[model samples]
Target chain A: MKNAVAAPLTGVPTPDLASIFGGFFWVGISGFGSALPFAQRMVVERKRWLSDAEFVDAMALSQFLPGPNVVNLAVTLGGRFQGPLGSLAGVVGLVAAPLVIVLVAAGIVARFADSPHVIGALRGMAAVAGGLLLSASVRIARPLWRKREPWPIAIAIAAFGAAAVFRFSLLECLLVLGPLGLLIARIRRHPTSS
Target chain B: MNSPLIELAVVFSQLGLVAIGGVMSALPDIQRQVVEVHSWMTASEFAGAFALTQAAPGPNVMVVALVGWHVAGLAGALVALTSLIAPPAVLAYIVASLWRRFSGTDWVKDIQSSLNAVSVGLIAAGAALITLSAAQSPALDVVIIATTAAFLGSRIQPLWLLGAGALLGAAGLI
Candidate 1:
């Protein structure tokens, strides 16, 4: 198992940096609101860069790590094939076109900030964005509810309180709650086993 | 005295490190610091910028770059984007390399579950905060927010919802 793990994953083509860049660049262009789905389709189905299981694994690790989840996935998958430079290529491709597009849009919006039409549209967009975020939060929290775990739910509530109700900075809340949550998880994972 | 660009770098890099659950989990803090602490933007302006992020493609973390551009310029955008991406990207690269070796270990599982809880909570808080900040007309925004949330997990594309919202606003319904 160790030897198998150490070797490069067989049967998967090792894409060059340009391919990685182009794949993510297309995802950047085509992904409307969220890029994860497009990225999954491209990497797994089209490019076959990684198998479905590996993609899921990368996603799991990306979630637990930091930054944007898709960005992390890009870096992880990129590094898996071609090391640090691969990671760089992946990210630059993913973000470059989108970055330019957003900045240009923002500049236009800012220029028209005083327009009543713009303001109305922005207000509507903001409301929808807020809804989208809440939906995402619910999706993230759903698994915990399904598992029927008490401690994780409690920790989640506590985190919400620390950040929203108490208005503590994110850093402070994480500092206080991160370890406590970890400890509970460790205890819960093996009440008697191990 | 720190330059604005330097301040943007400092602030976003810190955000990058603590962005354990992704940029969504960091939204509230981003809102507070950019709007309240630095006075770089008003609350509504920040909301507008954040809304634009959703309308754009690519990663949501581009919000950082948008804020930087608003505060400074192209240079500010570059600085903020790099700072936010570099730290976390480096951490992710290191962990991804090590992950396969450690995949079988129970430690990864434990961290995954715990971090999920932390991430969910932060994201919820962010949801509430953003909803509140984005509410220009309490009644109309509430309906819009509720309708949007109701469409969650549906086959309907999110762009359609956003477009609906823009149309509603243009029609003076929202």
Candidate 2:
């Protein structure tokens, strides 16, 4: 296992920093509302740098830690493909494009922050955002539903119920579900092994 | 505005460092801190701002800027925006370096798969939370549900949905 881990470190492709940087840049620019799912498809499904399993693993790790999942993915994927330098290129590329656009937009918004038209526009956009987020949730959940894992399904349901109905904090629900998920996984594995 | 600017930078920097599963997952936490703790905005107000940020083109983190701007002004927007995004960017740089060195192990693969499952759950929970918090009227709730259904049922581009929603909102239908 250790040797296999070391193998990628030594033999991983040394992609041109410029090219990788460009990829990250484009991803940042175009990612917008649905960028995350798109990026996952590009890297995991299209590029095959990491298998679906590996892609999910990286996402899990990224989410477990603090910070944006997309940015963490950039580091994990970039680092896996190249090295430390690759990660830097990836991070810079991912953030720079969006940062510039948002800053500019913020400037414009600052001028009209209180305008009725602007407010209306933002309200419309909010609905759209809600839609976009809903779509993202479906995309992420499809695979799990297909797998038909009862525990995961239950965990998802419980989490949703807790937050939506009971109005529990997300952190509280996560604290409850995270361990339950682990315990369930262990039990499932144990049954087969025994 | 100056104090808010400083506050924006400080608060969102903390948020950026802990915003797992994209900006959406952090919504609950941001609400808890900003609305519940700091009283920066009412919960509904935060939701409205979030809606605007989502409607705009760019990362969802742009909401930080909107909230900051609302609280203070342009300076507040800048501070919030920078703090929300910059720390994560820096962290990505560090993690990226270490990740490359550990890419090939089976354990790595296992970990990634498990995390993906968790993210799915987290994101789902996030959606539910937002829906509950933001949707006030049956009409508004219907719009949200319909939009979600449309996104799930078709391969239609997101921009179209956004455009249509904007049109409806402008027309006072939504």
Candidate 3:
């Protein structure tokens, strides 16, 4: 039942606090658009700390738990190495830049809230954001497409309609759609494949 | 009466606990609290904040900071940021340790696969919302499709795509 692709190829190599914090600090700073892939590159590619499979597994575990995906990855991966302190380092390193930048942006943008150019650029940025999100969706759903299953695909469409068109909040869609999808998967005995 | 700082922390920490399937999924609920429940900002303010944050660098969760700053300046910002991650970080730590230890176990495998499917649906839903919100003009539609195609077809870094998008926006194409 091994996933040949995206499988763990390495074991944990002890990384000290400086490396962990410094690595994640850069991840935060360079973490434009989405942070997950940056974190992935930092951990799995450059750091050689976690293999691809471990990163994916850690992501799935945290994705459903709470908070942001990359932040959860930071905390969880840091915990894997140095327990609570590691998690703390991960959070601080990943957040510090964004916190400061967002604060400054909030302050500055408020003063310029009525500028036509500013509004125009933000509108364009929003459109770009849409592209990023759409790319993320396709990447995540890529595996399900290969499996040739209609049910998970249906679930994806339903979930989309609920959130985007029907205007249901995400949790509302998940609460209603999650359990039913899980049940169907359990019945099929191969949940992810479908 | 409560200090808005305390209220910010309380509300965010509480939401952080229940904000499943990633924080993006929790954005609407957070908006509901800040705009409608807390009366800290108007609806348009909330939407603008969210839109700008999506286009910002770093983690997507920084929107919490923007909302807090809008509501009560720097203290509100700090409190909102802290509370948003504290509870979830603790839970994530425990779950990560458990998963690292028992991931290969049959029951663990089952749980992972089940949740993985749910994640797929949830992310797709989030994408849909982003698309609908971002799309306003035909030019923007072209930008969205081009960005998606470039991402799906090439190995170009997303930062480049975002930069290109920003440049296009600055030029008034989108």
Could you say which candidate leads in TM-score? 1
The true-versus-predicted C-alpha distance at residue A122 of model 3, in Å, is 1.2
Show where candidate 1 strays beyond 4 Å: A1-12
What's the CA error at residue A157 for candidate 2, in Å? Answer: 2.5
DockQ of each: 0.69, 0.40, 0.50
Candidate 2, residue A37: how far the Cα is off, in Å: 5.1
List all candidate RMSDs to the true structure.
2.7, 4.9, 5.4
Model 1, A1-194: lDDT tens per residue? 12112212467657878988998899888887678899889988888877789878888888888888888988887787777877889999999999999999998988888888888888888888888877878777889999987988998999888887877888887887888888887877788864
Task: Give the range where candidate 2 chain A is weakest over 10 consecutive residues by summed lDDT.
Answer: A1-10
Judged by TM-score relative to the true structure, which candidate is superior, 1 or 2? 1
Report the lDDT of model 1 for residue A184: 84
lDDT for position A165 in model 1: 84
DockQ preference between candidates 1 and 2, better one: 1
Please state the Cα-based DockQ of model 1 relative to the true two-chain complex: 0.69
- Report the C-alpha lDDT of model 3 over A69-158, residue by residue, as the tens digit: 888888876766776777788889999887888788777777887877666666666666677777878888888788787777777667
Rank ordering of all candidates by TM-score, starting from the highest: 1, 3, 2
TM-score for all predictions? 0.94, 0.75, 0.81
On DockQ, the stronger of 1 and 3 is: 1
Q: Mind giving the per-residue lDDT tens digits that candidate 2 earns over A71-129?
A: 66776666655666666777778766665566566567557867766655556656666
Expressed as tens digits, the lDDT of each residue in B1-174 for candidate 3 is 488888898889887886776776676567567766788876545555766676567888888888788768998888898899999888887676456567666555545455556567666666665566667789988988988888788878766666676677767766
